[model samples]
Structures are given as C-alpha cells and as structure tokens.
Target chain A: MSQANEFWVVAEYKDGELQEVTLEMLGEARKLADKAGSLVGAVLMGEGVAALADPLAHYGADRVLLLDDALLAQYTTDAYTTALAELIQEQAPSLVLIGATANGKDLAPRLAARLRAGLATNCMTIKLGEGGALQMTRLDYGAQFQRTMVCSSTGTQLATIQPGVIGVGKPDTTRQAELTTVEVKLDPNKIRTKALGYLKPDPEKIDLTEADIIVSGGRGAGGPDRWPAIEELAAALGAAVGGSRVAMDLGLIPWKRMIGISGKSVAPKLYVAAGISGASHHTGGIRGAKLVIAINNDPAAPIFQSADLKVVADLREVLPATAKRLRDMAVSDEQGGQQ
Target chain B: MRIVVCAKHVLDTSIPFEIDEESKGLVEDGLVYILNPADRCAVEEAVRLKERQGSGEVIVMTLGPAPAQEVLRECLTLGADRALHLLDRAFDDSDAYSTGFALAHAIEPLECDLIFCGSQSLDEGCSQVGAVIAESLDLPQVSAVTQLELGATQGSVSLQRKLDRGGREVIECSLPAVLTIEAGINEPRYPSLPMFMEALHKEIQVVDLDALGVRSQEVGRRGALTKHIGLGPIRPRTKITYTPESDIDPIEALRLMMSGQTAPSGQQSGDILKGEPDYLAQQIIRFLQQNGMTPEANV
Candidate 1:
C-alpha cells in the first residue's frame, strides 16, 4: 500500500447492496483527489462482500480496502470503530468522509475520539482550500446560517456528509480498482453493545427526500385533527405528505414527517407550503424545489416572499376545497374529452 | 441507583442568532440561553427514573463557561440532586471529540450506574457526545432513544431507538450504560416557583481541568484538531413579493399565480389571493390542468 495520505471514504452497505451515499462520497472524493493530486481509496467492511467493491471502483475509488470478517457482518459500535480506526491509523489517511446516517452518526464520533481527529458533522459542501486544507460548509443554528469549517493540518481530518448533498457521478463499467484485504482482529469480549433486533415501522411510510411533489404543513398547521385537509390536498396532487419542525415538536406529526434543516432535505419538482411561515430552517431544506406555492391566512408570511404562488387565506378552508376542485376538474376533463 | 445526566446551555434556537466576526463564535448579546431542549428531556428522564425507585440521586453535569452554572441549577430545580460545572478556559475551542473527552474524564470518578445525555445539542446537533463519552469510558452507548423502561430486575433496561426511514430498533441493555434521550419522548416538567427559588440558593460545584486530572494542552485550542477557516452566507436565492395584500377572487388569484409562475426572469410574481375554499378549489383545479399537474394533463 502507498504510504501517502489517501483521500479516503468509508463505504456504507446494507442488505447485500451498497448504499447510494457510498457512491456519492466516492464520486466527491474523486473530484477532490483530481484537484489535489492524490489517490482515492474506499474502505468497505463486511462478511463475503468483496463483490461490492466493483461498484465502488466504478463510482470513483482507485483502490478498495476490504475488511471482511464475521465480527463486522453486523454493525456494533465497538467492532466497526476498532477495525476502521486501526486501518486509518496504519494507512495514514489525510481525510475521512462518512455519510450522516444513523450508523454514521454513531460511528463517526467514536472514531474521531479514538483517533483524536477533527469532525465536521452534517456537512452539505466540501472543498480543499488554501494550504491544502480540507474546508467544508454546513448550515448551522437550525440551517438559518451557513458556516465554513476547516480541519487541522496535523492529524486526519474527518467529516460526515449529509445524504443527497454530494452528486453521484455516472458509473463506468470499464473502471476498476485494486482490491486488498485488511485483517480485522476483533475480540468478541470487547463488543458490549448487541443488536436485539430491528422493529420495522409502517411499511407504507413515504421517503420525503425522493418525492417528486411534496405538500408540507408548518407552524400554522394546527394539529393532527386539522391535518386532514393538508392530507387531502396531498392526495389530490398525488404528492407525499410532510410536516414542519414545529408540527413534529408539537407531536402533531411523526418525527420522520418533519421537513427542516434538522430533519430531511427534499427537492421536489413542485412544492406546496400550507399554513407555513417559511422560516429559514424549513426553507433551507427546500432550496432545490423547482416550484413553490404558499397558502396562509396572513398575507405577510415570509413564505410568500419567495414562493411561485401566494394565497392569503386559511389553509383549513383552502386545502380541502382545492382538493375538491382538482377531483372535479379531472372528472369534468374526462367528460369534456368524450364530447 | 446513581444516574448522571450531561446537559448543555445553548442559545435558544427559537430566536435568531448571529455569528461574531472576530471570534467566529456566537454573539452572546441579547440572546436567551436555555438548557438545551433535548437535554431537558434527558434530565427529565433521569429525574423520573429516580422518582420511580423512590430513592436515587440524579446528578447533572456540563462543560461550558461559568454561565453554564445556570443550566446545572435548572436541572437541580427540575429534581436533580447535585450539579457539577466543568469550568475552564482551557477547554475552549473544543470540538465534539475534545469536549466528550473532558466530560468522560470528569464522569469517571462518579462511579454512577447510568449516564443520560441528550441525543444532540439543539445548537450544534452533533449527536456524538454521548457516544463519545461511552467510548472513552469503555461503556456501551444506545443513542436517540424514544421510549425507555426500567425493568423490575435490577440493572436491566429496555428501549426503542430511532432508525432510518422511521423504523425502530428494539434494544435491551444492562445498567452502567450510556443512553442519549430523543426529543419529545416525554413531557419535561417545569419546576414550581418554590423549587425554582430554592435552586438559586443551592451551590454549584465548579471543577477545572486540574480538578478533573486532565492536562490543559489536551483540550484547549492547542489540542483541537478542527479549526474554523471561514464564515459566510449561503448561496443567494431570488425573492419576489406580491403587493396590495388584499384578498382577491379565486379566478383572478389563479391568473396571478399563473402569471408569476417560475418565469425565466422579468415576469412579476402573482398578486396575493384569498377566497372561499369552495371557489378557490375550482380555480386551483383549472390552474393544475393548465400547468400539466393533473392526471389528464397530456390529453
């Protein structure tokens, strides 16, 4: 293995498939490597998962450092951190990027502590700055403000990238990477945390990030009892439903339904903001939206300032009424076509 | 059973906060600082667990400036038995890794049976401190717990943790472990007026790096692995406002909406529209049809 500090990305995989973020991180690392005159390496750990390296290579990795061991088959905080930290120490990596998922959130900090490295959490952008320093930007104070952070020139620089922030380049089947197996010496006694089992949530839960059209309710959205109208409008538009941070904190909606900097980031072709004041935290996540429509009783709501459409009316009345109009239009269109 | 809860005094995220240009940190003037909302849940959970046993001590700890003493007192008023403030300028400019290191060092001597921390700080939202502390202390960490129940058997606990896509992981762990409580798990109870008044008089134990047996160079700016290089605003986005904020008829509003649509440039944003839901509904349907949003738009 080359002794130079390589631009490294730890691949996240599940259910015998590589997660999309892994490819996205590799793609990003490829760009950074090209600029800094460095090599890109991907650390993929699992049992009998060497085949997955092909996809990582196809995405961006120049070499795949495979750590295949039964101890790592299931993710326990202890085993994964120990194995990766050992490899990172020996390989002398300059920077490490991880996806900001649940496991990532749990793993990144421990590794940082073990390695005594710097960690920038939930970064939306990454770039190498002056003096060959790794500079990253993230929305903070609930995404209302943006700040750029720099990692030290000393030890390994570490960061966790938010999902969907980095673009995944088109894969080239012709691309290939060198696969090198790294031995994982894990003692079963050191593993204290055990996975009891996963309890699946409702199968019908919608992923707000991937929705083409999204209808979100916010501060003015009274409660679950008042949510039906919003739901009705979403159904009429065939869009996924979401709620704002205030709605989720008030227990009017589930946490996963929250649409804000603290929650999920979404980019839909059409977005309808119902009873929302459009605070920067909520608006920050929707920057990628193509078209925005705002509905509120108060015409002075901040949402109207940037929305494509503005409504100065009560959402409770407008939502269901709009849904009814949509259905009626569809029905009448069918009749008009027959004529 | 003895339980220790880690709390933070952070800027109230409900209000707007500005960054200090010189220090590259928060400008602390005119801003209300409260115990982190998420940490409040952890403190509440610790108090409730103590109350259930009818006999246990809840100790709250924090690593921050002297003003952080107030947060420890707040925890006390909320029913905690003791408070410890890890105060030192030597700990400044510490990131999640260094911050957790100092906290773990302070907590090691307490020899508590359980440790509680908020899943993430409201201001930073790193979601790493509790896990980092666990790692430093060589204990198992269960994070972002929504539902927690202490078993009748000593040293046994059950929890439901948040997973990706709204799923949950059922976890069963033993005592002497670290748990990061999720927000909205349980309603945090406010202290009574008398309790609040009493908390003011209670003494807050202040400890520095020397007291914690950690060297100054290990946690201060000198020891930090991450540094702030730049501060700036986000990418500028376009903004337009509707004038004469009067409620208009549904058809006119729909016309305005269509006119203002995501035009390339130079086109005006539509007028503000307000009308009865019944009438607005009709106009919206027509608008969708014209915009190709309805099912039969292609036709």
Candidate 2:
C-alpha cells in the first residue's frame, strides 16, 4: 500500500475571514492525515491572510502554507489558478480538498486543466480508500442520485466538498502548528479579467443553503403582496425564507431567493412549503431536507406526494394560524420549563 | 453588421435522467431537447442588437445531428434572421475543443462582425467552448457577459462581464470579438405569431465537412483529445444514530422513542387560540402592541 506523505486542505477565505467550509475540510483532512500517519497542511491564499493561519492550526492543520500577494486579495480565476498550480507543483500534497462554492467551481476546473489532474466536484462525503486513494460522493442527475468517485492518479487528487454536507467538529485550541508564508509571482497583464466592486446583497437576508429550517411560499400564497405571512413564519422559526421559480417569475421574490434546478439547492432539517404545487423543478431544491411538510389549498397538489406531512387547506387561512400556534407553544414550553 | 449566435441542443434539465448501459453516459430515452437556456438568451440579445441597428442581420448556427434543426427553429422563432445548421454523422460524440474547431471553420466562410454563444452548456458545464473557439480563431473573447452595447461607428463593443466575486466588470473590445452570454443576462423573448409563422418557411442552410472544404478526419469525435473512460453510480450512505439525554428517565418505550431509529408518528399538540372576530381582533391588537407595532404599521 502506498502511504501518503502529506494531506492538504485548501482553506477558503473571503475578506480575510475564513469561510466555514475551510474548517469543515480541515476536519475531514485531519482524519485522513491520521490514517496515513502524515501531517495535514492548510493552504491559505489572499492578501493579509496570514492571520488566518493560527485558526487553521487550531482546526487540525499541522502546518499552514500562506500565499500572500496583492493580486490574491480578490478571487480572480487567473491569479488563484496560477498560485494554486505553483503551490501544488512545489509542495506536492497527496490529496487536496476544496469547497464546492461558486469560486471553487470556477477555480477547480481551471486548476485541474492546468495541472492535468482529475477532479470530482460538489462532493457530499469523502474518505481515504484502499491504496491511498480518495473516495468522493456527489449528487448527479440534478440531485437524483449520489455518485461516488475515486482519484487514483499519481498527481494531486482533487475533490470539492459541498458546504453543510459534513460535520465540522470543534477546533482543538491546544494544538499549535508551524506557519510558512510563501510569495507567488503574478503577472497583472496576463489576467484578462479585473474585479470591479462587489455588490453585497443584504446580509440580514437568510442564505437558503445554511438555514436549518426553511419556510417557502408558492403561487398559492395568492400573489406577491401576500409574502408577509410567509416571512413572518420564517422569522418566528429563525429559518430562511424561499420561494418557487413561479413565485420569482411573478416578482414575489428576488431571483436569488428562488429554489429549484436553476436556483440554490438547500438541505435543511425541516422544510415547510406553503401553497406549493410541487413541480419537479422546484422539488429538486427541497429533496435534501430531513423532513418535508406541505400545505396547499388543493387536495391533489403534487407536493403532498413527497411530503412527510400534508395539510390540505388554504395557506391564506392556515399559515397565520399555524405560526401563531407554534409561537404560543414555544412560549408555553418556556414557562413550563421555568416552573 | 452580421451577427452569429452559436447555440447548442441540450437535454431538458427538468426531467429525470438514467445512465446508458452501453456508452456509460446519460440515457436520453425519454429526454426532450431544447436550445440551451443561456444560448436562447444569447440569440435574443443578438436579435435585439440587430433590431436596434435596423440594418444588421442576425444568424443562428449550431453543430449537431440533422434533428438539431428543431433547436435552430427555436432561435428563428426567438428572432434570428436566418439559421445555419452544420450536421453530419462524423460530429457525434465530439468534445468542446473539436466542436469549437468545427464552428470556427464553418464561420470562416461567412461574413460576421460579432459572434455570441452561451457561456456553458448545462450537460457538460464545461465553459471552455468560447475560450477554445477564440483560441482556434485567434479572436478576443469575453465570457459570462451580462450586458452588451455595440458601437457601430467606433468599431467596438462594450460589455459587462460577471466575475467570480459577485461583481461585474465593464469591458470594451474591438469588433469581431466573441462573447459568451451568461444565464440571467437577459429575459429571452418568446416567439410571436408572425415570427413563428415565418420560421416555418425559413431555410436552414445545412453545411457538412465536405461542403465547408474541411477534411472529415479534422472534425468530430476523432479530432477530440479528451474521452470519457468510465462512469460509476453515485450512492450515499446515511447513518442515523440517536443518543438520549443523561438526565432523562430510562423507560423502555421512552428509550425506544428517543433512539430515533424509527420515524416520528403524528404531530404534537399545540396551543389552540380560538375565538370570534371581535375577540380575535382584540387579541391581535394586544399582540401587536406588545411587539411595539401599531395598527397603522400593520400594512
């Protein structure tokens, strides 16, 4: 059996703050490093990003490779691909893992092409296989099935793991590791692209992907004017609010809040869909939820077919009542516990 | 100002897909094909550009089987002035690199100032075609364009490109440049009655490798460098284990319920707030006041 020398996890940072997926990848990488009897290295690239090394070390990285440069400050495909390619060529880790975010999706394919390596993307789970190979599982056919793949090539085995798919264990603050800062040479002229300014959406708005619970409204919610009930329910539960593409097309919600094949994929603990007809396009987004509850005025709505719980009633009448009931139950439970 | 919009026919993403046993690829048994949504957007943008210019012509082109004309008709319905279909048996199973090569060769004979294509096809999601076509034809290419403005007198076009960081860059390039339109770049217009009727009689000029003066060996699957080796099924194993709270009483039925091995049964009871309209109205008003909201602010 071939033993891997070093295991590497590409730590993603935005605005000098490490993203949650980076810590999640490090947790998985540490497990693989233990099995291979090798040290785990975390690769951090960006300007003023060296400060993230200590946190990475706390989260199972034995050493952090810091690539600090002005060009690296913003995520341009050219600069990232160039820096990652150079680091892989020099350090030559046995396995590399990245987050399957938008930035990672664009960066991974380009890096794989440049490095001449095979990559499995949007992985839900990854583990060390026999003969020091990496086994990865990702959704295929629009989240219909989970496809497992293994990278057996000699070069770096790359896998882009999806966020919230794996458990991110608590960091071990006691463990301190070495931090090595490296500078990458970048040519500004070769970068055909430039970063214009970022348009940040409202941070107060819930990100559908990270929400533990989601309350979605559909066409049956009457119209765009009736979204307040949906938002109220979502706010009461501290859940993200989502809408069907039909709702988005009708201008009830922004395009970013649409959930379906063309929109964001979500995996929440509880998904409460109100007035949804459950079109296959919209169902794709809620397939990952642990529990699905559907409420619709039509008794024959397709949503009830896949729902774990179904309430055949008018959403206009039922949603407000349901939210009130849940809120009262919560308050009563708090009072009972105190007594 | 002749504009060429390159389109691709892709499997409808709204349906379920199975893997073919023979080729180890997606099975298209019950699949319906459509002009890739982004490419439809591209065709719409090109048609809009032509309408703005009034004298320019917009042509839609695609490389696929003879049946691919259905997709070309869609472009015509969306408002392309003409259609060019490059169909042949040899082009089957071709990768992006070879497809780009064939497209560049086909357009070599046509007089075109600007070329547009979908940023990426949904099936492959490669996003390499526009760049590869640019490299093959030696033309400047901008990808993931969200906005476009053509300057006829200046012989240049300015565009807004979607970058990785949730931002857009405005770039100006000379004419004869290729642009790949991103999804959500524009709302593609549906076919009108007149356009739909006209598209039926519109002739789609079919070109093959022989007619284009290109050797058959220089195109199609044979010219492709990358090949699919094998496909594997994706399976995820979910292990659910539940632990009980330490302070909880250890009764047999309660312990079993807490294990969570079996799914929960029915909904638990909740506070039932029932009353007539007057009582309900008063309760609602009280709740709103407690929440620091007034009746006037309810709307």
Reference contacts recovered by each candidate, as fractions?
0.57, 0.07
DockQ for all candidate structures vs. native: 0.30, 0.12
Question: Model 1 captures what fraction of native contacts?
Answer: 0.57
lDDT of 1 by residue, B1-299 (tens): 89999999987888976778887767878888899988999999999988988998889999998888889989989988888898899998777767788888989999998999999887778777887789889888888898888854677788888777566787777778999999888999978999888888777899898899988877767666677776656653223222333245767667657754433211125687777777766666655555566755422
Chain A only: TM-score of every candidate? Answer: 0.65, 0.65
Provide the clashing-pair count of each candidate structure: 0, 2
Off by over 4 Å in 2: A1-8, A28-41, A60-62, A89-96, A125-137, A146-159, A175-178, A202-339, B1-6, B16-28, B53-66, B81-120, B124-180, B193-234, B237-299
Candidate 2: give the clashing pairs: A146-B234, A147-B234
Q: Compute each candidate's TM-score over C-alphas.
A: 0.73, 0.63
**CA lDDT, every model vs. true structure:** 0.81, 0.72
DockQ-based CAPRI category assigned to the predicted complex of candidate 2: incorrect
Q: With candidate 2 superimposed using the best TM-score fit, by how many Å does residue B115's alpha carbon deviate from the native?
A: 5.6
Model 1, residue A308: what's the lDDT?
Answer: 69
Global local distance difference test of model 2 = 0.72
User: Relative to the unseen true structure, what is the C-alpha lDDT of residue B36 in candidate 2, on a scale of 0 to 100?
Assistant: 90
Candidate 1 RMSD to the real structure: 9.8
